[model samples]
Target chain A: MVQPGSIVGGLLGFLGKLGASVYFLGEILRQSGIGIARPRLVVEQIHNAGVLSLVIIMTSGLFVGMVLGLQGVDALSRLRQEDILGASVALVLLKELGPVVTALLFAGRAGTALASEIGLMRATDQLSAMEVMAIDPVRRIVAPRFLGGAISLPLLTGVFNVVGILGAWFIGVYVLGVDNGAFWSQMQEYVDPEDIWEGIFKSAAFGVAASLIAVFEGYNAVPTAEGVGLATTRTVVTTSIVILMLDYVITAALL
Target chain B: MDNLIEIKNLHFKRADRPIFAGLDLDIPRGKVTAIMGPSGTGKTTLLRMITGQLRAGQGSVRIADGDGMTDIGTLDRDAIYRLRRRMGMLFQNSALLTDLDVFENVAFPLREITDLPDRLIRPIVLMKLEAVGLRGAAGLMPSELSGGMGRRVAMARALVMDPELLLYDEPFSGLDPISLGVILRLIRETNDVLGLTSIVVSHDVEEIARLADYCYVIAEGRAIAHGPPAELARSESDLVRQFMAGAADGPVPFHYPAGDFARDLAGD
Candidate 1:
């Protein structure tokens, strides 16, 4: 049984270690020339990370848009701001809601998988094997994943935005008998390309943060099943925190 | 005779706890030097330090000058990587990449480090796989392999680079007798055929006695005895005698205390 102060100290130590790990990863990337070499691998990783994540992202997007449309239409109908329905949906999906929700979904699905896969590699000494063969594990393993996430996030966010808006449009205009032209016209007037850009930027940043956290946790995992589980849990939690923080910052800047 | 690897007064510490202190050794070219020790005597650490995986605190490790006899410790990250290409290591576990099949696992280093075409790469990978008797397992994933087969696949991967130096960390740990014989014979044949310098860290005394041209007995963070296996067999040192004979009642006692024994007996 650890003392309460010791627990707090342990938490602080964990945070410090995480910070150092991120710094070390940055150094590895710089040293390995990951930004330049292995472009094809990065593309492959992006396809895997972003495209493979689409089914879940789309599913979540559709349901979320439906729920928001139902609730917002119900509340706004009483206030007689029903003409602002498309603008409200567009605002929520473009600036704040879509990226955050997609990131949370990604953290649960792809993020955990990345952590477990890398953790297993570490546990099995495959990473050490790469070092002995003179192959840079960072370039071969980590860089691809990082690049994949960076590329995938914006693309996935775009998918979320399109799908989400369509779902909201169906609910607002077709299902609820709201004026279709007014909703789209207001959306076209109010929602700039910069709004979409902000959401994408936030999503991309979240993707990079999530990938970094997952890979770091996996690479540093202790040699046990429990350690892999712990790394997965930490990856999800840390990615969620980062996504929420970035969501606020991006929203404030854009709005 | 040229020494393939030379270590002068190597020292290492982990978190300020001394793992090795002032260790010196030489691995001659074209020979197998077996490191025999009980567990936790820095055998693995010594191997890791030699291969540049871990850095030594206070010593110089130099490889032969055939391709620039660089001091391993002074090399930059790129140089270190290039230097590592000249050495091969078979880890305690097979350590085959789970994401790759057998052929791809063997071909991984070549693919990453060289621009060899598929026509060139396929034959080379197949040849290596055939050497380890795993050519048929080329398409199989690592999960499909038995323990011995996994080790063989790892051996193929290690040897694909045609390295000058080979390090085997407890290669005989989890093998059946037939598999052990095959592995031992392969190691001997591979070293002789390629003239590869080899260092095998093992606790398998019988295997070391049979195979090692020269042997070092490590205990208590030091090489307690070092010589030909025959010479070490005749030593009067109690530590060497106890280790060679596999006695539990020697200078190295069991780690458990009397209180633990009493507790075990009382079922507490």
Candidate 2:
């Protein structure tokens, strides 16, 4: 049996990190007031966090949609509803898979990059250099990167949803012999505007959470090679867990 | 001599290990003051305190701001930043922003602090780079520069603001002999020509001897010796002698303190 003392220790450690993360968020919000005034910095990070992750995100979306298409055809053929495969694929992409998978892939690619880059900066004293130069590192560095990731994820989720629907379309209508008209029409009838909005809202929230964790881990990293590696690992782990938890909560409430 | 900085009864600790205890030192205006110590003796920490990067747990650090001495610990964040604007620090790693090229790195402070037109800012940045003898390397990225070149670019960045106080942390460490000679000359020339006070944290006794007007050698949480480099070179203190002469062993032991070496080796 697990010891009670160990359980309490784990709980306390988690709570400590949670508290520190909240304080970090407050600092980012405060600094972002200044950071937003400098559009160029935020735009540069958008390219780092959003634009660079395009290949992996699109590739993963296509494969995931193709898999879903295969499964939906096999399952729906028993009920003679394979014609509605497009509706199932679109609804899944927008309501669940689109935002969820995009965020997971983002944590793997962009989140680790943000964490390691800033962690390396800290290790090499770039952040301290800024402080000595009278530049607030949070305002000048962290906030812009945070804002960039927060802006990019939702947009990436939109792209993922579109690509995923098209992937399913190719497989279901062309390869599997489902009627193309029935496939698209069924999707238009079933997938509501509310479903699309739900995906958008979820993606936005996950973006903020992922960006916050990455920056917080990086900013507070122990200034060593080993420490930076750990922070990068923690960024991906914490972001993936938070995205899943947030997805569940948002889905329950919206449904 | 008019002092540019004063530390009074300063006390600081890192996780129960006392880094500075009742330490006091002064930096004279318009001179290069070298801080010398063995590794891990908090030379860099002292510089951090002077810049308000790290606060003392007790006592005060007062830096001359205009005509008044502002107690660094008493100031708010905005006030500290205002004080820091008049200061510049060259980190041990050179700390050039990797994303920017040489010209932009030198131009960073000016662009951030002032809305100077590009036409005006360009000349000022080029002039500082020219002073550091890197005017032609302006377009190169930081990765393209040699170690000496990187340090020179960082020095130009430090001087671009025309700061009242400049701090160099281990400026001579890992430099080739030619780079060391260039930095030694720059430190002296920069202080004299610009009328700026400099506090250099280094263990390079030869370079400090050539560049500093006065020097402080700190150890065991306090300044153990302070005098002109010539005076320190002639000191009787065993620890100071060990440090100045670059001896391998003396008052600062060569071996780590431990139980019997034989017993430890035998896993007893």
Candidate 3:
């Protein structure tokens, strides 16, 4: 039967897990510093996490931008401010949707993959083997993946922002009869560099959070098939919640 | 007795379940010491404690380098990692890195621990692979290799560091008779040629008896018998005799405890 005591105990256990995650993050950062010694390793991780993620980011950004253009034209036309479609698209994509969506997709894509890979490594005893060989598996294995994800997400967000802007331009100017002069002039005036930078910064934070969670969950998984599966699930769910929460907190803190 | 590693009154547990209580054992220098016992007797746990992978609950798990002895149970993480560099361990599953090929897997420790160039690393990797008779399989990924080949590759990786001590956890399991003979021979040959201390944790009594110079048999958290393999073969302890003889029925119970089957089925 459920009891108040059991509820309190469960909450305390979750808090303990949170504390452990913080410690694990600290260890990852420490190992990442050692990864600097082997710059090639970090580079390799970046290629996998950042470079491979570009395609989806670009595609999604373009489509989202186009949708924003269509919606802005419809919504603002009633207010007779249809010309501001470019400005609306630019502002929302740069300040909010682009980074958040990219990070969410990345969490689903790269984060789960990272967790599963590391979890499998633990189950197979490869991590133990590395420890026995006196090679810090954290430094050699995790640091690279962590650094890679951190570096990957922001760049992916950047590509998303650019491609998204181009898509908005196509729809707002050529496809529709919106005035190109108004579209260009209004966006140029209203969209500040700082707005774009906010998205970039938020996405970078998301990347670190996502990557760290993925690696930690994998590395500390229970060394079983079910444990690996659970870690992968947790990586996606936890990373999405973290990215969304960080987006809000960062926006509040910075803006 | 020139012991390379020693454990004194060691205590370790799995949560509330005690695996070792005041356990003491020694690994002699430049010789093969075997710890043989029934399944779940903590033979592998003893190896992990020596390697500093698992912490002992209490007491000393010490290893001697040329400079001095380091108590594994008390040493900090960095110190333990530094100490581990001077040793090698062969895990039961071979534990070859799935991402890397046989050559890269074997060369991994050397690359991480030393700043040796690829030119130098290549030759050393090849030599170690040749030692294990897996030189031709260097390019094969771990998944592509057979079980015995994986074991050989892992063995090559273990010796690549030229460690002061080599700890083998069930090196003989999951191998055919021929492969088992080959591995047993390789272990003895490698230890003698490299002049390294070795410990093999396994229940394969016949192979261990043929390979191990000194043997210790543990049961239910303590050593039941220990001596030279010849003396251990002639042990007076009933526990030792039953273990060494591989008897089906002994002091060790065959069935796990449960309620009476007839009463349970009737749901009384």
Highest TM-score, which number?
2
Tell me the TM-score of each prediction against the true structure.
Answer: 0.94, 0.97, 0.96
**CAPRI grade, predicted model 1:** high
lDDT for each residue of candidate 3 in B194-246, tens digit (9 for 90 to 100): 89989999999889879999998888888878998889878888788888888
What tens-digit string does per-residue lDDT give for candidate 2 at A41-130?
999999999999999989988888888888989999999999899999999999899999999999999999999999999998989989
Per-model chain B TM-scores are 0.93, 0.98, 0.96
lDDT of 3 at A123: 98
- Order candidates by TM-score, high to low: 2, 3, 1
What ranking emerges by lDDT with the best candidate at the front?
A: 2, 3, 1
**Residue ranges of candidate 1 with Cα displaced over 4 Å:** A1-15, A28-36, B67-69, B257-268
Q: Which candidate would rank higher by lDDT, 1 or 3?
A: 3
**B229: Cα error in model 1, Å:** 1.6
Q: Ten-residue segment with the worst summed lDDT in candidate 1 chain B? A: B254-263
For candidate 3, write residues A1-32 as lDDT tens digits.
89999999999997997899899888888777
B228-268: candidate 1 lDDT, tens digit per residue: 89999999999899999999977888664456777789899
Decoy 1 TM-score against native: 0.94
Model 2 - which docking category?
Answer: high
lDDT of 2 by residue, B1-268 (tens): 6898999988999999999998899999998999999999899988888888888999899988778888999989999999888999998889999989999999998888888999999999999999999999999999999888899999999998889999999999999999999988888899899999999999999989988999999999899999999999999999999999999999998887889989999999
| lDDT of model number 3 | 0.88
DockQ for every model comes to 0.89, 0.84, 0.89
